[model samples]
Target: MGDRQDAETFNNLLAAFGMARGKLQLPCVPALKARYVQKVIALANLLEKPLTSAQVEELETAIAQELAKGFQASQHSQLLISFQPNPKSVEQLDFKITCQIASLAEFYEAALKDNFATDSDQLDRLETSVFGKHANARVLDLLPELGDPETTTILDIGAGSGRNALPLARSGYAVDAIELADTFCQQLQQQAKTENLPLSIIQGNILDPLLRPKLNHYALAILSELLVHFRDADQARLALAKACDAVSKSGLVLFNIFLCRPDYQPTIADRQVAQVAQSFFLTPAELESVMDGLPLELVDRHSVFDYERDRLPSSAWPPSPWFINWATGRLLFDLEPPPISLQWLLCRRI
Candidate 1:
């Protein structure tokens, strides 16, 4: 009980759990995962001494990061992981890592099985909750971006559960919702059908050209809260080109994304955790290079939180519980403020 444990001790626990550094992506349910915690506790008991609160907290973060990595490995496409710090239950061993997977697994698995039906669920300790109630405050400002909603067409890429697309449709905009998840697509579809809104649900990756039947058909393309999941600048470049290609000449492409501030270089650990949390970012220069040859021209940039928060009434408030923190880059890393922050970009098609 005298020795304070560290990452070395934690590494030993991971070995005992059969989740070695390279093989942490094993899938299991919460009860089973809870059992893994007990097993690791037993191993820690047999070998290492009781850990200090600081040590336990450090281990908890490591576990959260590792779990996020495993989760990122589990996804078919890029998945935003919400790595929370709170232990699922801290009573048993005073350590937290293995138990953290329970929340993420249950949530993502249910959504994957089309069972996520409530308004929203916390994606992680950071409150990276998905399936929020309100449309983005910024997305609601479409009227000024392009005139006459009835005459203009907008594409909402990665349109999760009609958050933005549905509102746009309700406001009488002819909107095409491009969504990847079947559950989100179904939700948007049913909602649109029920309301008889001018929203069409197109299911698939936004990178696919086939998804867009006609070239330059949309007056605006919005990739809200999407670009962060992209791996690097290459993916961003391609996705931007596609978004630009989908819009008419001089049309607009509106995307909100995290870009690294000057002189802030993310380490390998930071990058991995970001990918796990779906908070991937490119440097502003990298972004500029990516946009160099593309038809899209950056016309405007705004601080996401400041721009949206200032515009919304106090009653509208956050737009969603997760919107404020997530927009400001508070939830991307584990308790550490990321060097990157979100920006609202409005680009015109050249």
Candidate 2:
């Protein structure tokens, strides 16, 4: 009787342990897949028998390290999809893909909730390194020239986390944001209210006519890090046209896009095609063609290279220097409609 009781207890514990180590689906990216596999193996070993609190903590640390390595690898291996030059006129470029904005909202909710598991300082560091310092400063530099303090109302399209909007509002600009992510929109609103900053936030798609009409009243429209989500050229051009229409005469549209050199072609995962997430890379000439009919003038244009010094933290793999070089180097073309590169013409509406 004693032996049987012990056996039953052991079986129950084993079952519970298995349940604790849930199956993990590997990300499609190569580096992520490798990292996830490593984590699974480590976790399996840790769950093989009962562990003290310290031992469990140690295993957790090992898992985190593996994930961080993979994240770094993924960032290093990131590449922009390449665009092939087509003889067709820019207006003729296919632009029919429609995204389900709700899907994006769901993705944001999951991402934000998961981020809470990370340390605040670590998150801040990651944000600064990956997003805040490098690219945003370039965008912020143009704000002074993009609008006048008293006269202009600014529209920040694709205003994720309200990063740009928050600063603009604090600077006393009349700012409004259009964000597609539900959780991000909520967070933005909460932050704005908490900071006592004045900014209007609209949670909706840029393609929605009724919801986006608010954009037409603005003097300056900013589309930072937004255009790359466009999978089709026609769709992107239409969005651009709508943005142009939203601005008043002599109004400015400041935007940036990720483009690949003609020699480099992106794999399916790089373009997010496998997941049906929309994305596209633009060629220099192709971008210019899209801006032909817009009433805006070119102000200045240059290609900004985005380079990363470190790797991403979410990936579970080892870092590869060659992959990092390829992923971190990006050609950012800043344009004002009636197109140019880096910075473009400042055309006055006729």
Candidate 3:
């Protein structure tokens, strides 16, 4: 059959199947319903041999029963159901899925780049896009609490694009950022120069001994989205200890890491399967244990829900449904609040 005929035939089958399965909730229009039933019957007749009315009814009943049973079986599994009232938008759904696949493809491509943009404008945009305004405000909010001194010196570890560094510098804090990516270091320097912000960028591993001596020079330090990259617990702990030592006794060492929960069976994303393998998720308790012997004290801890608004300023999209289920439903962490998945912590060196 032609494509048009095939589409009509499919719609008819869908309507009839929906009705028999008690899934159809459209308007009670006799004409529309009749047309739908006719299409379904036509398809059924094509699939099987010519059937009497009784045979058609019997087949419909059998199909409905099977569908209900399938749904019931699915309920026992950890499957999430999203209701879409209109099923006529298969093209739209296909387009959306295709776009997502394309975007992921691009992300992998960009991940392969030897250098990424970390310019001031780029950094600001990245921060605002990824974390939103509230997170930016939170960073600023925590800054003053670090206390004013002769000069505000900050060590931003994992300083991806200097998101926190630029803001801190704009606020008059002298910022020094350590990033492994040379491209990011160049971008950061350009951004600092453009804004005339006294920010310094060092291209070297934080684990390097050559960089070790310079660690104790900062008054404050931050490790936003950094700890998750470390594979060894002892290394992370040692890094935190070094951060504590870098800052003055009264200075603050602020950072955030991805906390793992019991239900967190490692996934492709967790393993960086899509991109270069780098990040490791850790349990909050495991992190606390890592910091046990360190001089840093956990002054505050909370969870940040990532919510994003569309460009049109419509409704907000909560963290991906999969993330919500993984973080909250799986009970991965001993989330102090009892249910949150992502943990944000602030610490001060004693």
Across 1-350, the per-residue lDDT of candidate 1 in tens digits comes to: 33657555666555344321111233322212334444444454553334455654565455546555555444222212222222332322333244223332344446544532343332221111354556766667756868888898888888876767877889888998887766567667777888899999888876665665347899888898888767678878877888888899999889988888788877765665565565778788888898898888888899888887788777667766666676677786544555878898988999
Minimal lDDT window, size 10, model 2: 91-100
TM-scores, all candidates, are 0.68, 0.55, 0.53
Clashing pairs in 1: 81-277, 84-125
Runs in model 3 deviating more than 4 A are 1-109, 112-135, 213-216, 262-279, 306-340
Cα RMSD (Å) per model? 10.5, 16.4, 14.4
Deviation of model 1 at 264, angstroms: 0.7
Q: Please give the TM-score that candidate 3 achieves against the real structure.
A: 0.53
- Residue range 1-350, candidate 3, lDDT tens digits: 36667545676555434421112222112223234345445644454323457645654454444333432332111111112223553211100000012121233235434232345444434433332222233356666666673376888887765667877887778888887765457767878999999788877777766776254677778886576556557768877887888888777887765566555454433333211223345665777689887988888875533411222122223322333433332333333543324455778888
Collision count of model 3: 3
Against the unseen true structure, what C-alpha lDDT does each candidate score?
A: 0.65, 0.52, 0.53
lDDT of 2 by residue, 37-78 (tens): 345445444644333455445544544454344333332222
Best by TM-score: 1
Model 1, position 4, has a per-residue lDDT of 56
Clashes of 1: 2
Residue 42, candidate 1: alpha-carbon lDDT:
49
